[model samples]
Target: MRTRTEENPDYCAIESAMEVLGGRWKLAILKQLTPGTLRFGELGRALPAITPRMLTRQLRELETDGLVTRTVYREVPPRVEYTLTDAAHRLDAIMSQLDTWGRWYRDTVRPGDAERVT
Candidate 1:
């Protein structure tokens, strides 16, 4: 299979990266998964705003993109866990930078509402 850069040499890298991480919930999900593996219910509880269907879709997409791994255990009640892959771990630095930029923007550019809340 041709790699993205090989297939579309002219495509902007940022656009390509956004294609994989654009959705509202994907980044949040990735942030939550950064700590360690979590079960379906655990993820759901952690992200109370996400519906079950949306969470499932986001997880499947993340898995397809090789960012996350899902394992199913053989047990009477059944157990499943999701964890970040090595490639996903590489995103930690980027995400942390983004988080810093987000805080800066919130404090410097758009401060009133967030400041009031804090």
Candidate 2:
């Protein structure tokens, strides 16, 4: 699928960024990797709501976007791990700001609407 960034050369730079990180799960995945490397199953455990299939799909997209690196170890059980790339690390401050804003929104704007927010 051709994204808006690809089809419209005149699109804003933010559009290009959103193309890679705007999805519901991409930011979450990146946030999970902020601490350090984690295996596929470890990621799944952290994000209990995401199915194995969806987790795999999001990880693949993150890898394609150069936000995450996937490494495979030829161990006895064949281990695989993922780590955030330098580009992704650069967003740490931004992500922290977003988290603070999200907390404010949930607390002030939608305090009693937890059911609908979910």
Candidate 3:
């Protein structure tokens, strides 16, 4: 099925980015990989809330999008690691701004609601 972006030819650059990073798990996965390369198991542990299947799928999609790279080593027990690409690294500033905005929004807009659980 064609997504909203696929159907609309007038999407701006931000919309294109959102199409790539809109999913629940993509941003979290990217954040986890921002530090350094991590094995599949390490990623799973870092994000215990994500299922193995979902993690694998999100990683594959990120890799395909040129935001992440996957490397495999040949050994007695094969090793695989994932890391963010330069393109993804370039997003650090934007992500930081987003983080700042989140904090500001929480403090200014939802000051007392911070402790409230969804």
Q: Tens-digit lDDT track for model 3 on 7-66? A: 445746667778778788988888888889999999999999999999999999889788
lDDT of 2 at 30: 91
Q: Candidate 2: where is the Cα deviation over 4 Å?
A: 2-11, 111-118
**Residue pair clashes in candidate 3:** none
Estimated TM-score for each candidate: 0.81, 0.86, 0.78
Q: What is residue 88's positional error in candidate 1, in angstroms?
A: 0.5
Top-down lDDT ranking: 2, 1, 3
- lDDT tens readout by residue for model 2, 38-75: 99999999999999999999999889888999999999
| Structural RMSD, model 2 | 4.0
Q: Considering only N, C-alpha and C atoms within 3 Å, which residue pairs clash in candidate 2? A: none
Give the TM-score comparing model 1 with the true structure, all chains together.
Answer: 0.81
lDDT of 3 at 104: 74
Candidate 1 vs. truth: CA RMSD? Answer: 4.6
